[model samples]
Structures are given as structure tokens and as C-alpha cells.
Target: MQGGLEFKTEIELLSRVHHKNLVSLMGFCFEKGEQILVYEYVSNGSLKDSLSGKSGIRLDWMRRLRVALGAASGLAYLHEFANPPIIHRDIKSNNILLDESLNAKVSDFGLSKPIVDSEGSYVITQVKGTMGYMDPEYYMTHKLTEKSDVYSFGVLMLELLTARKPIEHGKYIVREVQETMDQTKDLYNLHEFLDPAIGLGTTLKGLQKFVDLAMWCVKESGSDRPMMVEVVKEIENIMELVGVNLDANSTSISASYEETSKGNSPYPGYPYS
Candidate 1:
């Protein structure tokens, strides 16, 4: 009975929300205690699969950045554009899916809750989210807000850069990245932390900017974090810096991803080690 209620809630939420970057609900089934949600088929599977090497497809630097932007756009829409403003309480890589062209689409809204502006800016409820991706403030105060999603997205950004799980071998990726940044003031040291498969040594400037944005999103205080709208703008700027013309057309971005992946080493003369 309780499971049925949760399913109804998710259906009610997803049915009313529509965006290019969010998974579209096709239909649902609720017969004989069997409940199911039919969503648009996303061929590329979850972002977690891509990062964990289970997808069999390599997400190069450009692809990763594009995925990040797409996810951010979806979240921005949910927080800013959606009626009543929805908060995706569970914003983790596993919930972010990709299509055949590798375009990201946020999915799994079972834990989502609508923000009642009248009650307050935040919804005080039981903290419900994945372990590694949950926001500290939300966990501590049980005050859920859009910023909690930002914090989880920050962890997602780190996963994209490092191609590592949020928690590997009992070590938190965010803490590790923060410690590394604290120790090394030079951006050149970024190569040491970034995923070697992307061959991102030449893209230091853009990567550095992305790191800065991620750090801001994961700040201890929700007030310190940038809004989702700001996050989208920053990602757009980063895409621009990387010469990705997202406005051109889908074909253009696809071609760019192909070309960027051709040369194994995006930076030939630059030192990778």
C-alpha cells in the first residue's frame, strides 16, 4: 500500500513536468499489485555506468562536459521553471540517463518533492538520498531545498572529471578533490587529479573553471552555493570556452564529439604525467 502511494506520487510529479533534458514519461501500469513506469528509452544507460566503465563507451572530455550541461539544464528547469518548483531529492549519477547520442536526461523522480513557497523556502522532511551524494546541510537539518540538488550535482561533476565513484575504497571523492585543491594552488597539478582517459592536459583553463564551479556548488552552506540558473550559465560558458557550439544543432555537437575523440591525446606536446 505504501509503495503504491509512492508510485502515484512519482507519476503525478513526472506527468506534469516536461523538459528536453528530463526523461519523458510514456505510460504506467498498476494492476494486481504490479506497478511500473514506462519512460522514453535511453540507449546509453546511466551516467554512473559510463563513468564506472560498464557502458563500454568512453565519455571523452567534450562528452562529459556536454552531459554535465544537459543535466544542469534539466535541474535548472525543475528548480526555476517548473510550477511550484520541484526539488529532485535524489540527484545522483545513477539517476542521470543518456540517449543514443549521449545527451543526458535526468530520471527517477520517486524521491522528488514540490517546494511549497507558502510554507517556506525549504521543505523540512526526512532526508532521503543516496549516501555519497546527499547534501550535508539537508542531512543535518532535514531542510531540503534546491541547493541540496546542487550539492549532489557537484559530486557528479567530480565523478565526470575523475571517472571514479563518489566513494571508492571508503574514501570520499569530494573530500579527496578538496584536499588536492588545497594542497596545490597551481592549475597544472590538475592533471594529477583528472581522469587520464580524457587526455585533458591541454584543456587546463576550462577544466580549472569547471573545478571552481563544482567547489562553489558543494560549499558547506546552502547560501554559499550558486543557484541552478547560475550553474547553467557557468556550464554554458565552459562549453563556449571549449569551442562547443550547442546552439548550432545536434549534428554539430555530435561531429565535435567525434572529432575530439579521434586524437587519443588532445594535448600532444603537453606533459600528461
Candidate 2:
């Protein structure tokens, strides 16, 4: 999969997709038998880095809300707004990229597939996605649907709030998060259970609300998961509660992410990391 020609096809496919929350393909290089995709170079790196103690920066409550909202916006667009719905079969923390301003962007479309119509859901013959992030229903039935992405998205949200890796050594960290939740640990002390790297100031109520929503997304039954539109509304509500104003017209997702990202400041002077 790593070759100049493969990279060419990838760029060609990605050029058709234009979304504020998606990592833009700035250009590509096919030189000396080396293929490289030149992306917009997000300064903040992947959500994995921030959640795994790699990034020195600590995301505060407001920024964390923005990151979650931004990622939801990206997935919502891929699921509903694209001309043909695109399923990010590999929706994981590593696939979620960030910008200089910490804006979330969906990356790595190698496993992406386009769904032309409702009937397409019934036709998928292969089950593909990350281990723990993969939709349980899809993982068992080999069916591909937008809801599958929702399921993976739920796992990503868990990583955000709990600051834990989605899967480690073939065991989903959800088991840990659920255990902590059952133990009645204070949500604000998520740093205790979460990746110690991301500074902790998140509210328990807010974190619990998102955890509930994330659980819905990763439901064992696909039909039970909410639609992308509903997901957008709920994420917006969460953001609003945290004081991020959202524009109504931007509900299309593409417009809304752009609307939110405009004039936003990067985490102040974190050495451009």
C-alpha cells in the first residue's frame, strides 16, 4: 500500500472530498520511486498523542469541547453530507488529526468506502475497521453502515473524555473506563484514570453526559445508535453548555466546522507543537 502510484490514487480520491474538519491534501510527490502525501501539517498532531502522554500540551475544558465537537462535525459530514456517504471504516484516535489551532480533522481514508444508497448497507461483504473501535454489529455481521462509523466514534469520544487508548494489547480500554465509572470515581479526576498527559479540568456532569452519548454510539445494536444529524445536535448542545456558540446554517457540518474554526486561537505558544 505504500508506493508512489498508491499515493497518487489516494490523493485523487481525497481531492474529491473537501471538509474543514478533514485534513486537506496540500499536494503529493512522486519522485525517485518515493511517494509522499503532503498534508496540511497539523501542528497539534493526532488525538492519540494528546491522549497517550506524548504531547506536552494539556487540553483544557473549552479546548476539549471544541476538539470533540470538531471531530463529530467531520464524521457527521462523511456520514450524511457527502454526495455518496463515505464510511470511515477506521475511525480511531490515530485517525483523528489536529491543526495548529487544535481543530480536529479526520485522516487516513485507506479503508473508506462510499455508500450509494440504503441498499448498499445490505451488500457489504467484508468487515473492516480497527479492533476495539470497530462496530460490534458490523464486526459480527460484516455489514457496513454509517452507524458503524458512529460506533467507532463513540470509542474515540471515550478516549477523549477518559484520555485512554481505545485498544491496548487486544483488550479495549472501555473495560477500564467502565470499571472506573462503576467505581463512582469523580469525573474531574479523570486524569487519575486517564492519560496523565492531558491536564484535567473537565466537569463530571459534562464528561458523564458525553460518556452516555459515546456509549450510545458504540451500542451492540446498530439500529439503537443515533443518526449523524442527531449526533451533531447533541454535540452542539454539549459545546453550548461549555460556552461555544454554534451557527444554525452550519448544520450541514462542512459550513458549521468552518464557522467554528474561524478566528480560533491555537493553544497559546506551545512551541508550535
Task: State every prediction's TM-score relative to the real structure.
Answer: 0.87, 0.79
Once fitted onto the true fold, the runs of candidate 1 whose alpha carbons sit more than 4 angstroms away are 117-120, 182-188, 201-205, 248-273
Candidate 2 segments whose C-alpha is farther than 4 A from its true place: 2-9, 29-34, 117-122, 169-171, 178-205, 247-273
Task: For candidate 2, give the lDDT.
Answer: 0.70
Per-residue lDDT value at 168 in model 2: 58
Q: Which residue pairs in candidate 2 collide?
A: none
Across 92-175, the per-residue lDDT of candidate 2 in tens digits comes to 889888888788999988778778656755446487667778776676567788898887888888787667666656556655
RMSD of each: 9.8, 9.6
lDDT of 1 by residue, 1-273 (tens): 458767987899889999889999999999988898999999999998988789888988888888998898789878876778899989888999999989999999988999986774799999788988888778878889999999999989988898887887888887777767752566635556678766654644488889989989988778889888778778878888888877755324334333432112233331110
Q: List clash counts for every candidate, in order.
A: 0, 0
Reference-based lDDT, residue 52, model 1: 79
